[model samples]
Target: MHDAATPSRSQPITAGVLTALVGFTSSFAVVLAGLTAVGASPAQAASGLLVLCVAQALGMLWMSRRHRIPLSLAWSTPGAALLAGTGVPDGGWPAAVGAFVVVGLLILLTALWPHLGDLIAMIPAPIAQAMLAGVLLSLCLAPVRAVVDDPWVIAPVILTWLALVRFAPRLAVPAAFVVALVVIVIWTAGHGGPTGDWLPRIEGTVPAFEVGALIGIALPLYVVTMASQNVPGVAVMASYGYQVPWRETMTVTGLGTVAGAFAGGHAVNLAAITAAISAGPDAGPDPKRRWIAAETAAWSYLVLAVASVALTTLAVSGPPGVVETVAGLALLGTLGASLSAAVSATEGREAAVVTFVVAASGVSVAGIGAAFWALVAGLVTAAVLRRR
Candidate 1:
């Protein structure tokens, strides 16, 4: 009984390009941080990144084909940061991979269990939105903090970005990146030294798995990836009116994580904030066309994963400031929008605020970060208040 109409393929190339661009712009920094935190050498980290990107792309492809939905997959940015901040340590890759396999299996299992999907479905919308907003707030603050450290470096880019966003929304993020990169290039050219070497280098590393590493790294990674990233990712899809099967999507994400982990990539999951772009009207009116974009993203990711080692090297060798600035700027709009939505949702404004505060607090309990606690707290608050 599925719709017989095949999704349009006309915009495959465009979809691939945009997905990759967004990946590069938003994820490189967190990916680097995760690899290095786990004691990966520059070369090893690059290889891992390549694997991660590939896993993400492949997962998207599989999901799109199976459900005929444009569901894109991505590495967990917050998960990467968690690994880096908590120090995943050396010899942890195998454990991490093991954890991925387990999570994926769980997702697949959930797909067969309608009760589990219904349970997740029961979670209130406001609380979910609050958790997402809180998790992303720190990412938003990075660019602003960058300004304080190097106003001369970040000011013009921020100002230019603000102007473009106000006057020409479509051009805002990419334009700001171009302008910032040019400025940085000119400045570095004039001020020689490490600045002269403003590009990532190519390198590779063989992945090694260890039980101890998994115990130390994988569990924490899984919890954060699921709580902070996947939960919100699913919520974002729902928010945009995508009524795709959550169980299937969960399975896809789980498999993607496992595949990426084996390939030396970190956690992969549904993208919450960025998912809005392709899911919205901009992708196309026909539901099928939007699914095409998701399919294209998957194929594009596979290509990237195969070339991850090389790509990671290049990213590392590239000017760090430029990439960070570009990514931060690209996410600015998304951050603002999410914040607005979280606040505007009826009946959950206070819960959302609480969730935001808890998530932004940067507190960690028993290895879990603020995002998890924020959701828990917000849900509890909402429940208690509802009774009154």
Candidate 2:
């Protein structure tokens, strides 16, 4: 007979595996889209996914084991959305890689210089959330657009997503991805399956800095990642009675991002939504034993990494909008959450709305993306309103 007082390994293990599965499936499409949007070839994008998985996996294992807590990590999905919006920069793919490296350095600086993190916190929450919502807007609309473009392929994917959202919210996006995979396979079989290296491989990029990319891609990527992932991640862990070692985490993730940049990854940070899955009471009755869940999740990410090459091949070679439809469905929840938070405070509503408008406009000026302009516009509006 099992003792009631003893913690069950299976509980944390199950929670951990689910966390990794949900985390990867839900946002990997966004990651691929982001990398490709910013000038990566299909091979480079696949490398990005592979390296990101490895970086976050190793980081999670280190953090969880060192802290003895379920310190979950994730790729920055909001940052990916920002990339999808930004498009190719002045120097193209190399420039984008440089921006990624710069973002990593910024994160590292945030760890070394406390005031850096403080400055990020100083950015009004409404503006930040609004910017995230704006970045997510177009991607979230892919399903709606896809319905017009290819109704048959998208319908089953959407139905699967909707069904899972109603019955098993946690599994919703992953199930949708599976449906998308099935559709891709069938479509590929009809049109001659995609030809590519089935095994995982890395395509390295030498970073090249440009003013436009630094301002447009790197700065906004840092802000979106820090605001959406790291800050919320700390809060989530706090809710579960675990205090994350902020500096240590930042250091690990920062270095990881720098390393991954060479292999085409955008950014890696602490997990927000999936953290709850591994840290919550569902993982185990004993708080001390919960670190096992994070460790398990790290391993699970490694396992998921094995499929990156195959998935990337299908996504790149499959019919147009099929993978994007799944990406759109995956981001729907995040879009809703960001929109809600954007206008939650009445005092900042106008500024937030301005930020959203500029960002969603998808306008670029003087080589700078709308995300940078959104911040500028929102801040100016907030200051003017304060004066009045």
Q: After superposition, how far is residue 133 of candidate 1 from its true place, in Å?
A: 2.4
Model 1, which residues run further than 4 Å from truth?
A: 1-12, 30-45, 63-71, 76-102, 167-171, 177-249, 270-296, 306-311, 314-323, 345-348
Model 2 stretches astray by more than 4 angstroms: 3-7
Candidate models: Cα lDDT each: 0.63, 0.92
lDDT of 2 by residue, 1-388 (tens): 4775455768899899999999999998899999999999999999999999999999999999888999999999989989988889889999999999999999999999989999999999999999989988998899899988888988999999999999999889999898888998999899988877678999999999999999999999999999999999999999999999999999999999999999999999999999999999889888898999999999999988888988899888888998788888888888899999999889989999999999999898988889999999999999999899
For candidate 1, write residues 1-388 as lDDT tens digits: 1343322334444655576666654566556766675566666576667767776777777777777776767787766654554344344544444544665555555567756545655766556556655655665666777888788877887888889878986667757756765665566566562211223333433444554444445544555566556777777777767766677677676666666555456777777656766666656656666777787777766666555554444444444455556556665555566578778866778878887788767676664445556767888888777887
Positional deviation of 214 in candidate 2, in angstroms? Answer: 0.5
Provide the TM-score for each candidate, comma-separated: 0.69, 0.98
Best by lDDT: 2
Note the clash tally of each candidate: 10, 0
